[model samples]
Target: MADLVDSFTPSDPSDKSPFTFLNRLPTKRLDAKITRAAESGIPQQGAQTGGYTPSYLYLSHVPLFPLYSDRQHELLAKEDKHKQLMIKAMNDADPDKKLTGGQKAFLGTIGHLVGAGSIVSTQRWERRLVGSNVMSADSRMKQDKLLIFTRWTVPAPPGRQRQGPLWFVDVLEQRYDESSTSSLKSLSGNATMLKVGVADGRKVTLQLLKTEAKGIKTQKMWSKGTKTDTCEAMTFVGDNEIVAMEIVARIERTASMVEAMEVRKRFDKEWLVPMVQ
Candidate 1:
């Protein structure tokens, strides 16, 4: 999938954040337009000889505890039923249930195994997932003029169908045309993957991925120091891609051995999973 965003190369390679962190962020006030962010990325001016301002995208990471999907809920229910069955079997004291002394010893071993496995605990939250500030901070700190680029992490819950977190995900596709003073949902679908291309060109082949921004909410926030309006959105980071990959690994470790096992099994199956197992 075309990564919706190209990860940023830090101005200071030592800093792990995918953005350039200035000792003091520049105070120049520029509207969220491609013409303004040119100090960092490509210059949109003049290049549009007979043309106009280009587009910009804002993407940054935020720690999240994703809500369990419906399928995951079903799995938990099945596992719970089996657990009750196992508990009853372990404690049965009838003559048939009352095992010989040897059977009693075996039951003790089974109990220990159950205790060890019970740590496969998982957690969930209202689809709010993580705080909005944490989600947008990096992006707000990165580009001068920002245009948020997002991918739906998941559909919004029914009650919040309109003007809610889900609505922000839809905004990702609404490209703003400064000249027209309007916006439109672009059909140039493949625009997300281009290394570089003329956007107006038709037949764009776009690459896509499931960015962990399932229930994103973007809004105007006051930058207390500057007190200017800002845009923010949620983003995902998987392990093995950046130095922060270590963090994703650690979150899984504390969450569950099973979760860690599952992570290794799926992502680094040949290497880390076997070592842990």
Candidate 2:
């Protein structure tokens, strides 16, 4: 992961190209749109008609709470069933003994364990299993502080079929630190593990078990053949890699801006042509 990070070449901060790697990410683009709308000097509408005017449709990106895909919904249902069954078993064992908080927590962990093992079978399925939502300031702040790389999932492109190498995007959610026996945790003791919130209100424990630069061959919309681009990739650590890369890039850009400002300040402080003395 460190090697991959070291190998990354930061994009130009001043470049206004929307095709830039970060800008290309769906969530990043959505985030940018929201930010632009907020900054634009347009008069906001009344609460009765929704916050922004009808023109600003992208602002309405908030997901309904407990967002779940069909599979996630099924998993959740199974977990609920498991909990109910456990509770029933406890009741059957001893009618006098009430269910304790600890026991309930245990049952919840067991349920997640059962679900996590069956998250997805292949990378394609993994991409489909994930979903997207609006990135929140709070979530972004948390990710910026804790992770060296930004974590993101490569959501399947719109429509039935798509091609090309899967590029990772940073998930704008908080890290999961629930339980030691959590299914999100890496089974191997040697692997670095972190349970992170992904799309669809789902939490996944990713293990830093693999790292490689994947060559993504993408065909242009109008051009022929394919363009092979080397994408720095990692198994579960892609989030961390992106986070670190962006953070470093941000810091560098900020420093350059500050330096330029300071240089201007210094020039102003010193007489350019003897200060009209």
Candidate 3:
């Protein structure tokens, strides 16, 4: 069994497909294992058995930086602002106007700062999530880079039809181009798109429409109206549209941080280091 599993491993070191070991098993042997498990009242793991396991793209090996001090202070200020706004809204409510029970309850909650605090708390968690899992550096001295961690189906080996979809965590470098606004405007007027440059020189667009947050769309350059591929970077329960917009904001913030860090490094090299020398 060990030898059979080893045979399924991809020859390429970079091909970290998790299903390679199980999918490479011989048909008869694989069937027998499944049958034995069924006889023992245990289900086999795979699409065939209806057992699904999620794969995560971990950044444990990457060095992560603490949230920038400026950003931390900004979040704190925003939270305070939210609290003040909520309190003002409640106090400014028209006394002559009759309010529905739901409206009154909402006003009461907001007035107490519960609703406002929760909103700000969620924002803080989202920012921390990005800092912990998405923004990373190759080394302590390196500028932080934004990464999109997603699960993608591995392509079938050459000439062999895939028995089932095999998923593996894929790490993609997300590049932001501010100058591409004119080009993006040509795509769609209503939807906001993030044009990410992949490490392989391919352009991947993440479309966050005002109406929906379906998935990330990837297409080759200059291929307008062509069939594009879609993938999800992160999964969320309930309304994904809100989460998608938040992700776009987080990505932009991270990109800005990276840019700022680079600028500071250049300034240090040109002025501070030279003065010291």
Q: Which candidate is the best by TM-score?
A: 2
What are the models' TM-scores? 0.18, 0.21, 0.19
Distance from true position, residue 248, model 3, in Å? 22
Candidate 1 ranges with C-alpha deviation above 4 Å:
1-57, 60-68, 94-254, 258-277
lDDT of 3 by residue, 131-245 (tens): 2221122111112223222222333446888544322222222333234322232442211222222233322223322122233323211111212222334332223221221
Q: Which stretches of candidate 3 lie over 4 Å from their true place?
A: 1-60, 64-73, 96-148, 151-277
Task: Report every candidate's CA lDDT.
Answer: 0.23, 0.26, 0.29
TM-score of 2: 0.21
What would the per-residue lDDT of candidate 1 be over residues 175-275, giving only the tens digit for each residue?
Answer: 12233212221321211100111222222122123332222112211111212122132233323221110011111111111222232232222211101
Best by lDDT: 3
Those runs of model 2 whose alpha carbons end farther than 4 Å from true positions after fitting are 1-71, 95-175, 178-210, 216-277
lDDT tens per residue, model 2, 83-149: 3443344334431244466754544355344532122112112221221111121122111111111
**Which 10 consecutive residues of model 2 have the lowest summed lDDT?**
246-255
Cand. 1 TM to true fold: 0.18
